[model samples]
Target: MPESTRERGRVEASRGGSVRLEDVAVRFRTKKKDVTALRDVSLDVAEGEFVAIVGPSGCGKSTLLKLVAGLLKPSSGAVRLRGEPVTGPRHDIGYVFQRAALLEWRSARRNILLQAEMRRMPADRARARTAELIAMTGLTGFEDAYPHELSGGMQQRVALCRALLHEPPVLLMDEPFGALDALTREQLNVELNRIWRETRTTVLLVTHSIAEAAYLADRIVVMTDRPGTVAEVIDVGLPDERDYAVTMARPEFARATARIRDLLGAASAAD
Candidate 1:
């Protein structure tokens, strides 16, 4: 299958360095039958762009993110990162799951430093990075708190800080805020926008929320139902300078959100 115009643009923006998946398909073979989760999925993400993937339940959105994270391989086709085929999990990428997944025994600061320690970053530098991230995520005073002591939003913030501690060029988030209450989700959305702008890290977020996708993405990629494929890629017309008060009320924001919601509905009906 040929790459779409937006996918082509993403490839080009990588300046001869891109992440490409050619005719990617995933299938699980059981004793009785085969289950296909993704089919003919081809996408290219550029060097520094925030792309959100949205689809109905069981539409392979999470599977797609895992493929890029190198946690799962397509039964057919290839996955690559920055011109290199991703044969396994790459250090240049950081992944955040729906849950904060913090170790109960560790303090928030120690949790953030875990990944850095695994990568064998110098102790002094790791400590410095941990402190910086804590401050960045507004977790400064909570550094000594354990997972049980923090609220849902705070734990996720620690996870975000941990993901960025090593300064990975790409960050993959799978519905990281899905479990949060509405108010916390909105607050995190604002904080995430600020963090993304400050770090300039390319991000790919998978979410089921049309509002969340519209609110957080530079471009939203709507996917078809199970045996998922790209349905549409819509650019968010809202200004980069976004605030909850100003941007959410803008006509452009509503239009973008409606467009994506409609696309997702159509995709679901087609399933």
Candidate 2:
């Protein structure tokens, strides 16, 4: 949770633009049988806070994100935004997937404007937002560039710009850079830290990389396997003002990284 809302006691994440999941359990009814992807999963991300979820594969990390996004309904628990039930897709929360998912035919600028178009934003305002996004994400010169013309990192930057075009208060990222190379992923981590600070958007990121989660998240939420639940929530006590090289050198960062790894190891062994 961010310092701004710690006093409010996890209210924003569960009740408002800040996302919350309350004892949420989701079961899928497939043709063969019923599968419980998640059970008793509860979490809160305070306003302006960045939380990352890390766990073994099939831990329902994505399902948890979808619940908050209103793309999936919990069978036994509740998901709330601004104190209202999230029954369907919402425009106020933005999502970034593992892939850039940009249209092949559209240029970077047009791809960004696509969000505004879907939301029926005014043409003048959409153009203004598009320009601002292009500048902010360092796509100023490549506004006319198509997806293939850009590198993996650049493509993801455009995807991020599109996600943030409307300035949604809460941003949900599902391994947005999982497909990138190690060096590119490291560079984007730095960029993302800066962007998150500048935008001050509440973020909940699901990642497979412990190092990546430690670098970018304020709190790390560890989950159990299969019928997933919150195994632990570890605060990344390192300084908020973080840079890639220096932050990685800090003792606190090392401690956080090690502790999370141990917890995950323990979780794995228990299985």
Candidate 3:
């Protein structure tokens, strides 16, 4: 893609302008009860914006991503991507979970190519895209390595590569780096931010780490306890090109993280 086109792809938007959710609620029914997971939740993630969702355990953080992916239906209200209502599983979005979930038998490159196989992408096109992603994600040397041969962080990199193979407009990440050790997680956070900037793909990340959210997101959505509802949405107000060490030391980072921590603490108390 041309540089100008890539720059235009990063354009931001007002709330409810891109990915829109209007008074959404999710309920799960069991034999004995109808359990509410989310209630009256409304949020909008602007195009090319990096948004992070944080809340107490069981606040349906992961469920929110599922809604966007159209993996689950809302019991009330609506979930829309761009302008259209999400009625079923959306193939245009990329999703990554906490675990890499890579096929043990597949090499790193082959694992990423799995996305191409499923999508039936042209062989040359898929290989080119996979190569670009491998280089972009610092996985160049490990392409032939199997999952067990790579580190946890490396495995997650492969998962991210697969997720981005199609270059979807929106990426949904559910604690993609949560399982890594502190050092690895921090490293991946930096890489993720860089990747987002380069690709200009909108991202919605669900995480428990205040620092991680503060570091990566353009906006942070803090939620209440179970029956998850938006408590507050904070604009991070950081430059797109972020230096990890410098960013963590900034007052904006400190303030954002502090408020998120406070909100989570309050939610825990209520729970």
Who is ahead in lDDT, 1 or 3?
3
| TM values, all candidates | 0.93, 0.93, 0.94
lDDT of 3: 0.91
RMSD of each: 2.7, 2.7, 4.5
For model 3, residues 1-271, the per-residue Cα lDDT tens digits are 0111123345546445558898999999999998899998888777888899999889999999999999999999999997778999999999999999999999999999999999999999999999999999999899999999999999999999999999998999999998999999999999999999999898999998999999999889999998899999888878888999999999999999999988888878876
What does candidate 2's lDDT look like per residue over 1-271, in tens digits?
2333353233444434466678899999999999999998877667788899999999999998888888888999889765667899877988999999999999998998899999999999989988887887778899999999999999999999999999998899999999999999998888889888888888899999999999998889988888888888888876666878898998878988898898889989998
lDDT of 1 by residue, 1-271 (tens): 2333443233445533345677899998899998899998877776667788998888898998888888898899988887888888788888899999999999999999999889999999999888888888899899999999999999999999999999998899999999999999999999998998888788899997888888888778888887788787787766655888788888878988898878877776765
After superposition on all CA atoms, how large is the RMSD of candidate 3? 4.5
lDDT of each: 0.84, 0.86, 0.91
lDDT of 2 at 49: 86
Predicted structure 2: lDDT: 0.86
Candidates sorted by lDDT, best first: 3, 2, 1
The runs of at least 3 residues in candidate 3 whose Cα sits more than 4 Å from the true structure, single-residue gaps closed, are 1-15
